[model samples]
Target chain A: MAEHPSSPIPGEKPRWLDQPRNVTKVVWALVAVCALLFLSDVLYEKHPTFAVEYLFGFYAIYGFIGSVGLVLAAKWMRTILMREEDYYDRDR
Target chain B: MTAIAELAMPISPGLIVILGGLLVPFLTAGIARVYVLLLSAATLVYVLGLPSGEHAAFTFMDLDLQLLRVDKLSTIFGTIFLIALFLGNLYAWHERDRMQRTAAQIYAGSAIAAAYVGDLVSLFVFWELTAIASVFLIWAAGTDRSFRAGMRYLIIQVGSGVILLAGVLFHVHETGSITFGHIGLGSIGGTLILLAFGIKCAFPLLHNWLQDSYPEATVTGTVILSAFTTKLAVYALARSYAGTEMLIWIGATMTAFPIFYAVIENDLRRVLAYSLNNQLGFMVVGVGIGTELALNGTAAHAFSHILYKALLFMSIGAVLFRTGTCKGSELGGLYKTMPWTTGFCIVGAASISAFPLFSGFISKSMILSAAGEEGHFITWAILLFASAGVFHHSGIKVPFFAFFAHDSGRRPKEAPWNMLLAMAVTAGLCIGIGIWPEPLYAMLPFPVDYVPYTAVHVITQLQLLLFAALAFTFLMRTGLYPPELRSTNLDIDWIYRRALPAIIRGLGSGIGVVWDSLIGGGRMLVSATIDGAARNFGPYGLIGRTVRVGNGVAWVATLLLVTLLIAYSAG
Candidate 1:
């Protein structure tokens, strides 16, 4: 009689579902760009010859790749290492 | 050898400062306060006016030696140390606590003395004096936390001095000269001395004490604590051990590690402390490379780092004074209330982040360029990464979280006038040095040749900034970046803060159990021995009989026979 009762007891949908679809799309697009940049950097063995040349390009490409890598790594790490903010407080 | 001789004055103006430091505590509070300020100011002026190449020496008892030498390097450090003391005294002037005032004076005096020391022994004495005097500032904060931090700080600092002493003794024994010079890193004594400097410089893991202690110090106490100790170490390193290759890597690690902790730390002052560690890393790397340009970078970076770091701490101290807490989790939207303090903090942030036309941009670029020129590709890359990380934590995170983030609904009044004035003076120095680095460069140990405004350096730096900003924006938009929430960050210091104490307590209890058993066994043994002795020697026992003359005669006859036999054998 109550097979689906827990599904909609009140307004209990996860918060992520509430955001606009465009936000998710943009995030994916950024992720894709970061992956593409990383692969390109690995394949290309050359750096710009002049210090001033391609400065913005190199930074943007590499910085984006690094930031994305950091985010994913941190997310992975949190599953193992993350503790409650007050973990030390109880002992105190 | 005696090319430039001066009158061997026993009580020079330098000694006057040292003596004044000792005498200040005995004076009335009002007079002591004025006298300390005046004395420090006079010392600053005297140091500034000292001829660049002047060297003086004095000896006592034909064994104790004293050398007070003033050169470009010593003068720059000594002068700044005096200025720092003056400002620090002014900041703490309202406190009637004699211990704080006297310790502050001694700390400053010793640092100034250390700056001008020309031999290993003199440097060692002044070095330990600095360690002893500065701990009082930490203790003056008058909290259990401050007490413990001060104790740890003192131990490490004094440990450094002890190491330095051992090194000096060995060096003197080997080289037969105690004169301080560019003793290359070729021997054990030299390496020990380098380690001593490394500890003070807060190289890598040795850095936690700085962050751990500086925040726990009294509000005014923290300002004085910031300037002298580590900078003196840097000066010593630059003077003695420049161009050591390991320093480059150690410096790089120092630059990189602190940013993560700073990024997540809840306490603002603690965050600044971590930033200070990161900034010192840049200076150390420069010293390690030891090119003329790199050394200039190290000196310039140190000069600017001291100013900006002090300014940042002063701003945070102002906030802490108004509000009881300096935790980022508990603070926001203070700009509307304490605009002056916020503005000053922003100047410090911009200068530290190396924004165009800021002090950091001019000085830090020198080191990065030096890294590139030296063909240290990995170090150059890491430093570039660290530059962005600095922007993330110190430049953007500090000011934004404290002043511009969502209002935490706590409205505090602006900082007092004196605090604002201090911030203003420091802010001025930050700007002054950035706009015209020639003065700072000229005062460096080596000649300055590289210009900071080259097109390649500027463009590359700008691109790095833009990309870092873009990355930050991207993360913020995506909600993937970790938000600045109220939290405590774990760092290498956690080892001492949590693990060390726990381990000590654990080991203590474990040992206590074994000790308790051992004591019990010993007591049992003692009781048994006493009982046996009682049974044997009491009136009722066999040995209790009065043997007297017969037993004595037998024992003496045996002894004499053995002695005669040994003598006959020798013959």
Candidate 2:
């Protein structure tokens, strides 16, 4: 497999996305949104069907933990499950 | 006059499409596409016009059969299926592959008909028809990989049909009623039927066929394939196995596990397949709850899920169509070239992520709420976790890796106009449903009681999804997120695909060895017996020697004397 190319597309002016700073800006914006959402927990009236909903930023913490755990678990799973690209094709 | 008038019968929309599809190959390429679209549109109108309750009822072998059952549940499934058919045909308008077109039409038709059939026997007929018809779409790619994947897919699909038939037989014998109604796992028939549905629903271990095959199908073929088989199973489960307690855990497992696989998956299409499995989980949970609200959630979710899932598949298929690669490792910076597709892909991503104003948010929340309402605390918690996991993998990873990751510098043309239109329409449905789920909800099997856009609901959902996004961003920034690699991951299908075949080969060789040893031993025994006989009976032996003339005479006299003596003694 070819390694991912980092160079800008030839003969074309660099788009806004081509700059690393723009990506960082997007990430920072995402962080800000996350913070605002976490803080906005107080503004909404709560409907506590389960006890967990009463926790401050419960959804946020659960979501963050779940995602990180999933990624890490998947990364570990790759060690056992992953194989050469042509694994199935080789026997054929 | 009476006999002549009695010969007329109303046709099911499925049969209409199937017959129309059969006529596709005779038409020229350009005309066939238009004809299929028109025929599908006409069928959709016909389906819309079909009245509620059974109409095309008949009796055979003293058992009643309803070829067309139009209830609220079936109608919604049928409507969405027809819509999918029309959109699929329109999207695939550019292709001249008549076989794929025909297969797709029949497949869609069978699924629609299967949804509406009110009897188990009729359902089985359409079920197998769907299985038989849809394999060609996979095979349409015309590659060795596609061919093999198609075969595996066919075997599993048809295997499901076989199990369903067996269940139907037992069920008919036990109850003496062929009505396809709520069949809990109380009897062998019901359990068998659930297994059959589970196989198609991709319930955990039975799931690998979808991941194995859909990515192998042709571009348009994948789009068509995505809409039917699993959703049909969801319909079947909703019809029969509703309220089966076991399905709660089954559904929760279904919802939770696939996100991991989707996370590391390289093939964008396969990632969507995993996401499809996860989405089916929500529907399964709805069915398991079996309350009015929960079933409505199932129906609503199925409807919206089909559209968004198709949109995602279409986007990836378009990428595959244009760039000749769907591997995330090979695709990036495509937005610079195919901005429309990038935008459409994000819509699909956001919808699947269940953002505030997307289809999934409206539908999936109802199921979660159902779980919470019923005090299914563990399942509710699992679903909540699954929702965030979904956003991480499908919502972020798919669009990020494909369109906005590190530049691969491979600029391809934008998707065809037809494809863009199809995506645009499906995306519209996704957003429309999210905004106004009332129309969709009114079509449900029960009165709509759940509201999706409450402030608490909206803010909490946003909190869940955004934090998940933040986690993804953190992982990416930290270099902890798994890099997209060109490799195959083993799943449950590896047992059948690799392990079973290897075991069979081993057994065959073992049997060969045993047979060879037996034959060798038998041959040795026969040769040894012949050698012993030859040594005794040949010229050098005692009896048939050449010099036996004189010796034989003397021996004969001696023997005669001894015989006489013995006779005398006896007397």
Candidate 3:
């Protein structure tokens, strides 16, 4: 609930969201998080009786594939299911 | 001390809320605000003071009905319901619509009553009351589409109530008891009850009403709606159907399907609606697991989910309030002006996504751990995937689109102070519960010793969430992430909304055409009858040609004499 610093330049269009340097910062931070998770595996207990989860980076891979699969599937679904917003109310 | 003890005697908070709601319309807006807050706070206090057993019992037609069933389960739910009511009232403080306020009180009151009632019959009464009361909030929006949507929501809700009533009647007939306790699907009545709860829980295909109706509600209306309805269903399920094996698969499906739908949803509020379903799946799985830990998980998850989901709804609702739209495609760069809202929205996102040190991390893990320990391999796998999917859409995509995406250049002001206050309190609780869950855990139906913040849990959850984030980054970089489109996705509701109606209408019109020709045939019959009568009565008839009375009389006598002779010969 901390108040975010107000943008310095008033009326200056979108903040530095798309700047290459900022994107890299986010990517690097993500990489750091992944690396920490990989490292934490050594200290963390392995409770998996399932074969798939015993593998290194199993959650990472599972999450990655699951997310990508969801997006792809949803996109494919949209092709079949998506229609104009008023599809329900259209007069035949 | 005796007066205090008397005051602590069991009272139905649900009844209080409803009765108090009746007073809302009469009070000035300011007084009404204080009235709602006081009513909710008092109810919470009274509910907390109740002993953990049935009180407030009475007889109905020689059958006993328990109006208040005070226990750990009801306590947790009632507490959260009251908290939601308080926050919801605060969020809705600026609302000028009197009906929304009144309906909120009744809806919340009924939901609280449903949670506390001790018998199936009493539960049914409050169950239907919830549906009947809540629909007014949707209709209070006063748009034609909202009115139509409200009707649909009402039909489904009250229809659930009807099913519940039938189930209860049959259950009492078979078992000769109306206790609202576990009756698994061994009998038809129990199954009917499960279906009734399922309809409210939004079990997969039965789920379309949630995504359909919640989004159509007014800004504050959606916030209030999200808190009570599905969670009430979850409470019902946990109450009666705990450890039912079927719930695991159903919950898994509930968890998985919505994330995909949420991914491509254009309306941000609707996306939250889907996430709400996904979160309920976790609770359902917990209920299905039926272990003490799992049940605790379900209760805790529900408590946290209500808070975070309402927070999410409130944020989007605030957006809808200010900008008049919550479409992902139409919103961006709101952080430039609405930074406080953006901040609170992120907290809600993080909590829902189950990041460590957030409310979700503590509660959602209980179900997953239960499934794994119980060796429901497939259920665990699906839940795990859904967990990551939750983070992908709700955690990242929601705030990303609404506040941080390529700026659509619309800068709306920050949410009103009351809304911010509500979000702030909810946000604090989200973090607070995540950090220290003992208070929440103590309220669970059973003792909870499971630790949520172990090295293994944190690492695994982080790994899953970060990788999902990585996947999002990769997809976006590759230009493969689906652009938010202003389109409606065909779902189960299509049957009732269009397909079924169209089929009935087509059949009706076909019958109508046949009916029109049948009427035409009747017309022809009437025309022939008219012509014959005219000919017989007019100049062309035999009687009409006879002008002289004597001649007619002589002919009639001759005909009568001839007929008489014929009759005598035949005899």
Q: In every candidate, what fraction of the native interface contacts is reproduced?
A: 0.13, 0.88, 0.71
Best by lDDT: 2
User: Candidates' DockQ values?
Assistant: 0.11, 0.63, 0.43
In model 3, which runs have C-alpha deviations exceeding 4 angstroms? A1-14, A18-20, A43-45, B1-9, B521-571
Candidate 1: where are CA atoms >4 Å away? A1-56, A60-92, B1-16, B26-37, B61-66, B485-487, B497-571
Indicate whether candidate 2 or candidate 3 has the larger lDDT. 2
Q: In terms of TM-score, which candidate is strongest?
A: 2
User: What does the lDDT read for residue B85 in candidate 2?
Assistant: 91
Clashing pairs in 1: none
Provide the lowest-lDDT 10-residue window in model 2 chain B: B1-10
Model 3, chain B: what is the TM-score?
0.91
* iRMS (Å) per candidate: 10.6, 3.3, 5.4
The DockQ for candidate 1, computed on C-alphas, is 0.11
Task: List pairs with backbone clashes in candidate 2.
Answer: none
Per-residue lDDT for B280-380 in model 3, tens only? 99999998989998999999999999999999999989899999999998887788789999999999999999999999999999989899889999999
What TM-score does candidate 2 reach?
A: 0.96
What CAPRI grade goes to candidate 3? acceptable
C-alpha lDDT of candidate 1 relative to the true structure: 0.77
Tens-digit lDDT track for model 2 on B1-571? 5543332135678878888889998999989989999999999899888877676777777878777778899999999999999989988999999899999999999998899888999899999999999999999999999999999999999999999999989987788888999888889898899999999999989999999999999999999999999999999999998888888899999999888899889999999999999999999999999888899989999999999999999999999999999999998888889999999999999998899889999999989989998999999999999999988888989998888888888889999999999999999999999888888988889988777888999999998999998898888888898999999988898899899999999999999999999999999999999888888888886654666478879999999999999999999
